[model samples]
Target: MSKTSQDEWTLEIKPVSGWFHFHLKDVWRYRDLLMMFVRRDFVAVYKQTILGPFWFFLQPILTTITFTVVFGNIARISTDGIPPLLFYMSGIVSWGYFSDCLTRTSSTFITNANIFGKVYFPRLVSPLSNIISLLMKFGIQLFLFTCFLLYYWMNGSTNVHPNIYILLTPYLLILMAGLGLGFGIIVSSLTTKYRDFSFLVGFGVQLLMYATPVIYPLSALPEKYKWIVLANPMTAIIDTFRYAFLGAGTFNPGNLIYSSVFMIVTLSIGILMFNRVEKTFMDTV
Candidate 1:
């Protein structure tokens, strides 16, 4: 055999060893498949629906209105002097992105069981695709939120003071995505064995929103209870987002650092668990 021919024919397939051995290179090699899955998730979601992608815009809008009424009017939650509409919309947009990513990615194994069983590709692609699709949905909701922000700004709403902290918006988004993807994959991996976790995810995410600073400002929390809310990694991300756009929430560097560290740790653990589960989830699932 010629050297060139032997080299051209070289192929390696080895069993993964250790918990940290994520074949990221393989995932990169299957990038096209990842995009395909992303497109599939995006289209299949609204495929027979009357409104289609409009639901992206409508869901946040409706939720913002409901929060404005319930939390703003009824409970009289302080929005830290920002207009209730804008305040709630900001929270809704940020929280919605995280929640949507987490919820969708959490079902990777069960939803794609048949495909996983029939084919061999990087399993991470499935959840990564969900993150990308949810990002698209987040973009639509963000556009709607920007429209409201502009309307309020033009209307001379003094309470809505967008600041230079808005520069952190991109970082905030990346953190939110990391946290969602991390926690989601963890849950998805576990749900393969314990199906009940799937049922609990919905309820957990709903309760999680309250823990996160979604409807209310971090400043509104009394000093004694503030530490409790800060314990949630999402607290800093959402608070920073609100402060950036509305200039009405707390923006502690310590909190952001903590959230970033938590995201890294959670994502590391989630990926490890996912890698472990993907090898044998078919049998258990």
Candidate 2:
């Protein structure tokens, strides 16, 4: 066969994927829609709220105060020798970013069934936009955390200083985004098949949080449960958050690497499944 004939006769075949079938270039072509969805999320979130985005700052502040009193003052849990407010806030801010992302992204398919059915933009854009919107909230919470950090640095016993490992902050944020998006996509995909999953998302995420290392330090866990705790990737993420700001954490760099690998695996798998499901989800969903 000549080169021209081979080119002209090339057969079209359905795609098969082992893991990732990233449509990065295709996603780029739809970047405008991504921004539109992001704006839509932000605008719709506080369309009629009294305090608007200001509520973002209030939520985490009140949460940290409550946790500090109830868990630290009342329950007397250790903070690895760091101040209670700072310790809990570090965990809260990061966990809030992740859990909030998961909660919102979990609604990706069901929430946008009409849009997905009507439109042709990349479905990944929906969750990606929601994560960006969630990141704005995370940034606000982090600003509050920084203020608390400065307060402790000025007057509290907290030798508030970040380690060289603090440079991993961006990677940590990416890990959080990846885990939320990846896990949420998987759940959304299942929800299409099993109606029970809609209820499970909220309940499951709550129960899952207990397994994560948010309320207490990883060291506080019993030796037997250590493996179970570390098995949760959020454990590494939470500990790394503490390690970055308060220097009161014992995160292994190796574990962080493991978490990074796990996050990439999760996101890649999620994207692949989501792409597959979106094609036929309308009938089932």
Whose lDDT is greatest here?
A: 1
Q: Roughly what TM-score does model 2 have, to 2 decimal places?
A: 0.91
Where in model 1 is the C-alpha error above 4 Å? 1-17
Please identify model 2 stretches exceeding 4 Å from their true place.
Answer: 1-22
User: Per-residue alpha-carbon lDDT of model 2 for 1-285, expressed as tens digits?
Assistant: 355764576554454534455667878989998888888878898878899989998999899999999999999998888888888999999998898888888878898988888977778888899999888888888888988798778875546777787788888999999999998888787787776877888988888788887888888889998898788888898898898888987869888888888899998778888877776788888
Tell me the lDDT of model 2 at 48: 88
Writing each residue's lDDT as its tens digit, candidate 1 over 200-223 gives: 899999999998889888878889
Q: Count the backbone clashes (under 3 Å) in each candidate.
A: 0, 0
Q: After best superposition, candidate 1 residue 157: deviation in angstroms?
A: 0.7
> Candidate 1, after superposition: displacement of residue 188 in Å?
0.9
**lDDT of model 1 at residue 57?**
86
